[model samples]
Target: MIDPQPDGHLPVAAEKRTADGTAPDLEHGRMINGGENLWMTEIQSVLAQSGTKKTTAYLSHECRMERLPHSETYLGGGREIFQKEKPWEFLTYTQEGRIYQFGNPAVMTVPPSSEGDGTFPPAFEIKGCNSQAHCPDRQIYYFDYDEIHERLLSNQISVRSLFLQVSWSTGGDDWTLYSPCRYVNFSNPAFQTSSYIQPIAGTVLMPVGDSFVPGSIACSLNDKGDHIIEASSRVFRDMAEWRIRQEQPPEVARKSIRDVQQVMPTFFLSQDHIIPINGTVRLYRYL
Candidate 1:
């Protein structure tokens, strides 16, 4: 587990910029097609780093948001309504037959934007169900990505990284996490087909004090052909530490050392799993 901050919060690193005062280079180590949009360029960088040849930038075709449900439920008659006031402490999504249970707040659900066409801007729609009462129906809440981008640019909000869960179904269901500019590989052979693919986007951390803590998406399958998805902060902590050690100078890394680990600027993590599914499931998040 990541060591908790002295003040009981996750460490936040300031956004890095190039010496020229431009966005940090997404393809720093490798030579790839540098695109106009920094976000898309960073995603392409990830694909290139993951051993994907002929990497190209693409926008998400569809996006959906889901969160883990509260453990306790309100029983009325024969129906059980998921509690909305308090969500489960952990983030999780599980599938059993047609019923799906999510354990985090519903982050986003919208169709892909057509603004830049082939290019990816920080453009998207944010919506969720109303949490005011124990309403069983989902309500439409609307917001734009420009507002979010403005907040990040102005330092009104501090986000460490944006994480996306990419999923597809071939003979079975396969999914992986994707973050722009992070080196994570989804080695499934089905990824090459690029059919029935969906990208679930969201932040990987929960708010703590003035900053956010890191979390990871863990995917698994069961004999019953069910998909088990979990949001694990512990796994994210380990990955962050490993990345830090890998980036250190060879000589400095050779020595035994203990440093407060922080999720580096423009960092992300992703994993892949496969199972049988009827259709695609997508997720997205914004704050």
Candidate 2:
């Protein structure tokens, strides 16, 4: 876990050295608890110190966006932003002596290649979880490892669970919010059992609308602790693809899924065929 320094500056973890003074191995892997880059450290720190309104203000000014809650911004806007390069590269060590490098640039800029041992995949996004009930989004973050314990003791049921959520975009025209398609959860091993799982730990992959569907592939586990992947029903493929494209630009995501509509069959199941004169029936449909 990241500890605050006496001077209030987050101390970046020093690189690990072998007995021969050589660097350790670098590979992109799953998420780690309290493992965030300097930029994330800054963002998390600001969010922790500032209240909801103040945190929103800080984020707006830093990202150069309007002072509106839930607005989005790119890193170093313009050509550099389009590149989506990661900045501030360095190595961090887990308590188990494992070293990991950062790879995603959207969360931070890519540092000079020579400076660090290797890069792990970048986090998809690092922002507050703003919603209708949680507008300012300050309560959406939980940095302390014991946060859950405290919440459980206090019966704070409305607190957010995941530490970070990375929403990846699918090939679509409409602007949609997507949870990160790729991530690792160190705290919860149960969630790691399946690829189609949602956020159950400090980091999670959530859909814009907080829903999930099976993809074109089926995942089953064997006795040897290996995941067996195979082709699945066409219906599964179409559903997963459509859910993914929710991250696309508004125009593209708004485009019709004509292929899926033509190939897949639709069904409507209701508890009753007729509505009662004085009773109301609620109908809900997922897009």
Candidate 3:
């Protein structure tokens, strides 16, 4: 579970960067929980001293902001409010088998570009994208390494599952593993692997928002193991609108916390209930 930075490579803190994501295993492999971050202190310190405030991050939106309630939780250990808490709050998209994103990926066909040394060749992200894929569905990120620039292009969600790893430098080039969006079906590298080593069973369930309206969404999972996702209609908020930096705004938006604030699971998975409880919560805020 060695998390590379949003972009592939960043040395982990000598102490925290245990060369892996979790505990070292001598036999098969090592698995260090990504949450045991060495930089938690720095984030806390920076926020504390710099007068920065923390709004809860969650699963559904473009930039991950899942700040759930748990023991030793960041803020006082009680239930944490995230994504500014939508009008009808308290659920996330992770309840169902939505291993990719809570929202849908906007589909666009890009031509080609000469900027990204060909990696982007005016593809989906190279050109421009529809403002639909932001929240929950857009909570994916890759390492921003000097090389291997992986952009979540505003196009179709082609891959079945994605494995995002983030590691970064802190003390003297030391790095820390952040969160992870582990089982994204849109980019599953093991798509070919068919043999099931273990048999598991379970159900997945998501929380629905206020059906108080005549037409409200009811989260549910359909057969064939697909989560009945809520496709957000025309996204109004743009990352540029919230930009606090002087640098040129990115052509594509990285998603806001509110988009994912459904606060309830989109649906539920019964058999082989595999849903992520705790993982990396990464995002770039405008304001």
Question: What is the TM-score of each predicted model, taking all chains together?
Answer: 0.17, 0.17, 0.15
Q: Please list the C-alpha lDDT of all candidates, in the order they appear.
A: 0.26, 0.23, 0.22
Per-residue lDDT of 156-192 in model 1, one digit per residue for the tens? 4323233233343332323233333122222233445
Sort order, TM-score high to low: 1, 2, 3
- lDDT for residue 250 in candidate 1, whole number 0-100: 50
What would the per-residue lDDT of candidate 2 be over residues 229-272, giving only the tens digit for each residue?
A: 22221111223223525566645654444333434322211121
Model 3, span 145-188: residue lDDT tens: 21111222222121212222222222223221222222222222
Task: Output the TM-score of candidate 1.
Answer: 0.17
Model 1 poorest 10 in a row by lDDT:
129-138
Q: After superposition, how far is residue 184 of candidate 3 from its true place, in Å?
A: 3.6
Listing every candidate in turn, what is its Cα RMSD in Å to the true structure after a full C-alpha superposition? 24.6, 22.4, 22.0
